[model samples]
Target: MIRLGHGYDIHRLDSRENAGQPIVIAGVRFDGSPGHAPDFELGCVAHSDGDVIYHSVVDAILGALTMPDIGCLFPDNDPRLRGADSSIFMEEAYKRMVARDYRIGNCDVTLICQKPKVNVENDAGESVKQLMRENLSRLLHTPIECLNVKARTHEKVDSVGECRAIECHVVLTLERTA
Candidate 1:
């Protein structure tokens, strides 16, 4: 049997937390500097590294397999998860799926943000794809081609439109291989 799951997430911009650091979305880091800050000045805040891409992906996989969410498995209330690396979370989710004899068919992600330039050349989608593919491949014991990632801009109209925040949506398909 096969199941499909979709997940989405958004985080507000924090100039204080990420004042001079590069904005990392979906594991891809965007260079942020004065007059050249990757096109957006805002970022998300959380107990962990705040990688929306990884978080959404984790939720999508868990939801597809009727498993616990990232927070439920790695609660924010736990000090061990503070400033935690998202890759670990992804690995753990994949492990849970494996324990249940489920295999990942494919995963897709869309990132929506307003600034730091919407152009692909500056948005860092490729980097994100590479990282996700690598991590997912390791966890699922599959090839990297099974994962896809896309990014879009909100047209600078609303909160995301103004680059005040970033949003990510993830979809995953899982099959019971055993």
Candidate 2:
């Protein structure tokens, strides 16, 4: 049997007054702009590295297998998880899937933001795909071809359009291999 699942997440950028460490997105770091809003000061505030791409992907896989979410497995309330690596979430999710005898068919992700331009030239999509493929492949004991990733921008309108934050939507298809 096979199942498909989707997950989405969005986080607002930190204002200059409350700026913190730059949040890593799609494996790229966007150091909050310096100076009292000199140019840009935007970052996601979360317990982990706050990689929306990774978070969304983890949720998608768990949702498909009807497993617990990232929060449930790695709760934010736990001090050990504070500022933990986002890749750990992906690895854990993949482990869970493999334990259930499931294999990943493929995955696609879309990132919505107005700034830091996510495009092929910037290697945003490819970076995410490579990271996910590498980690998932190791955990699933399969090749990297089973995973895929992509990025997109919101044509400047709403919150994401305004570049005030970033959002990611991910979908995954899983099959029972055993």
Candidate 3:
């Protein structure tokens, strides 16, 4: 049996007071990049670590399996979730996938951002897309080849284009491993 799922997430970007780090996507810290402006860089405004990739991926998996979404599993009103890591949400989805004897056959992720170019190598010599692919593959126990990540600018049209927000969309094929 095979299942298909799609997920999307977006967060408003704002200036964080005295935040030393850069925006995090799929657990990668992006700082001082060809897309980062130290003086004007923006950060995601959310209760938890705002990782649009991980958040959307989790939702995709859960939605595919006919389960509750991240918001339902980890409600924003929960005080314990304040500033929580997004990876935990991914973990929960993975556990459910395994319990249901399903595995990711393949997934494609698209990210939209005006700053922090995804293909450009940051100061760490790692391209943001590659870093995200590796991180998500590791977290989901899916082969790296089964994942594809692409990013683009919002063409300066809306909040994303203005660099005031970031968004991600994910689609995946889930196959029965049994």
Best by TM-score: 3
Candidate 1 wrong stretches, greater than 4 Å? 16-22, 31-42, 117-132
**Rank order by TM-score, top first?**
3, 1, 2
Clashing pairs in 3: none
- Looking at model 2, which ten-residue stretch has the lowest summed lDDT? 31-40
RMSD of 1: 4.1
Candidate 1: residue 126 Cα off by (Å): 7.5
What are the per-residue Cα lDDT tens digits for candidate 1 across 7-77?
A: 77777767745643346665555554322224444555667777778889889888988777777888988
lDDT of 2 by residue, 33-137 (tens): 221111235667777777788788889989998888777887878888777778788788888888898877877777777875543222232443354455545
Clash count, candidate 3: 0
* Cα misplacement distance, residue 138 of candidate 1 (Å): 3.8
Write out the backbone clash pairs for model 2.
none
Every candidate's lDDT: 0.71, 0.70, 0.84
lDDT per residue (tens digit) for residues 1-178 in model 3: 9999999999888775533335778877555545322233666688788889999999999999999888999998899988788999889899999999999999999999897667766654656677788889999999999999988898999889998889999999999999
Off by over 4 Å in 2: 15-19, 31-41, 120-144
Residue 72 CA displacement from its true place in model 3, Å: 0.3
Candidate with maximal lDDT: 3
